[model samples]
Target: MTETKTIQKTFWQKYSTLMISLVVLVIYGWALTGLTFSGIQESAGEVSSSIFHGLTHPDWAYVYDGSGEDLVSLILQTLAIAFLGTVISAVLSVPFAFWAARGKNEGKLHPRSTTGKFMLVLIRTFPEIVLAIMFIKAVGPGSFAGVLAVSIHSIGMLGKLFSEALENMDHGADEAIYAAGGTATDVLTLATIPTIMPEFLSYTLYRFEIAVRSASILGMVGAGGIGTPLLFAIQTRSWDRVGIILLGIIIMVTAIDWLSGMLRKKLV
Candidate 1:
């Protein structure tokens, strides 16, 4: 009986608050939404009937019908923009990351000093969508605008990643190189870069995947890609075309995922 009471107490202690909170939240949600179990039942019935009447199979033949050429071109353009943007970002971030990781010194101006930190913070504060909009206005609409937008945003992101990687690196090799009369450049090339190379590559690949999706959406703002077609489909209420476009996006992302996974596996 003592053991039974202990078990009961433990069970209540674990679940009593959860059970009470669930009941309270349900009551409050129902009050807010003006919905009860009966109302949900009625709504579910109506939705079921509507779905049965409206649902239709896709026209798979339409996928192969002449749209393939246009789709392929748009996809290639998106890839090119993503690739170029990622390359530019990676290249620029390297020096920025190195500088940003350098801590404050008494006599020297450090890269991670107040001014540098503030600048990085400011750059990172703006959303990528906002940057994309600004670039669209500044450069006019095209893939170039999209590429620039991605590149700008990537600088902030890659800089942060690189700085973190630098901070976490084993400094023994760098110290040893310095002790052996190596210059700062030699120490960075021989010690720091080798240690952080894997991390840099991984981050770049991940950003490339993100850039691909961003480039596609930039087309919505007249930046050129599959998003233009997607927008058209939406405006015309072409569900079939929308479905096909979504499938294409899924395929492209999956390919990138598979390729990146393989590369990361080899890299790590």
Candidate 2:
């Protein structure tokens, strides 16, 4: 009888969190019931079949026809866009990162850090596609617009990452420099930068991987890359061309990821 009583007493302790989880699941199920899915498109079958057939039999000749619009040229352009955008964002993110990062003496709930986080949240929440469209209007729809969109969109994430790195970084080097009567610039260059540059470069390379994919998508909006021609091929029902473009993108992205992973391992 005493064992039974003890089990009863411990029941809530063992299952209270589980009961809360069940309640959340029920709430999610209720919310999902309100969603109404539309019927599939009538042409979806034919389109899917064509896409698959195209994939199996890609236009090999499109790989290089000496046309400036070939896959090789556009892939290079995409890489260039991602590289430039990532570099620009990395440089511009420094001030924002410093501003957002909490100082060593600051409390967890400091107003400055709170405001900076909120601002970064706003920036991160804005859609890159919308930014691309807005920039397209200003820049007349080209690779430059793509670059601008990526640069601005990337700052939100990069700043957050950089600030987090700063906040968690070891203070030993900084303290040592100060103890040695180092000037502010001396501390910054000799202690801070050397200590943090590797982290910054690692994050930048990861962001570059994401930027490459984004650059390709931006090309769909006439931002200038392989995606522009890929879209055209799709619209014209040129599945073979689509196949070749997809193949090129796959190869290019894979190569970049491999190279970046190697570089990051060294830098970090």
What's the number of clashes in each of the models?
0, 0
Q: Candidate 2 — which residues are off by over 4 angstroms? A: 1-9, 16-21, 35-43
- Candidate lDDT scores, in order, read 0.78, 0.90
Candidate 1 lDDT, tens digit per residue, 26-132? 99988889754554564777755543433343334445556544666678888888899899999998887876775423223553444554566777788666777
Q: Which digits, one per residue and each the tens of the lDDT, describe model 2 over residues 1-268? A: 9999999879988999999999999999999999998999999999999999998799998888788788888999999999999999999989988888898899988989888877778888876678888899998988899899889989999999999998988888888988999888988899888888999999999999999988888888888777899999989989999999999999988998999999999998
TM-score of each: 0.74, 0.90
The residue-level lDDT of candidate 2 at 138 comes to 93
Kindly give the stretch of ten consecutive residues in candidate 2 with the minimal lDDT sum: 120-129
- Strongest candidate by lDDT: 2
Cα RMSD, each candidate: 7.1, 3.1
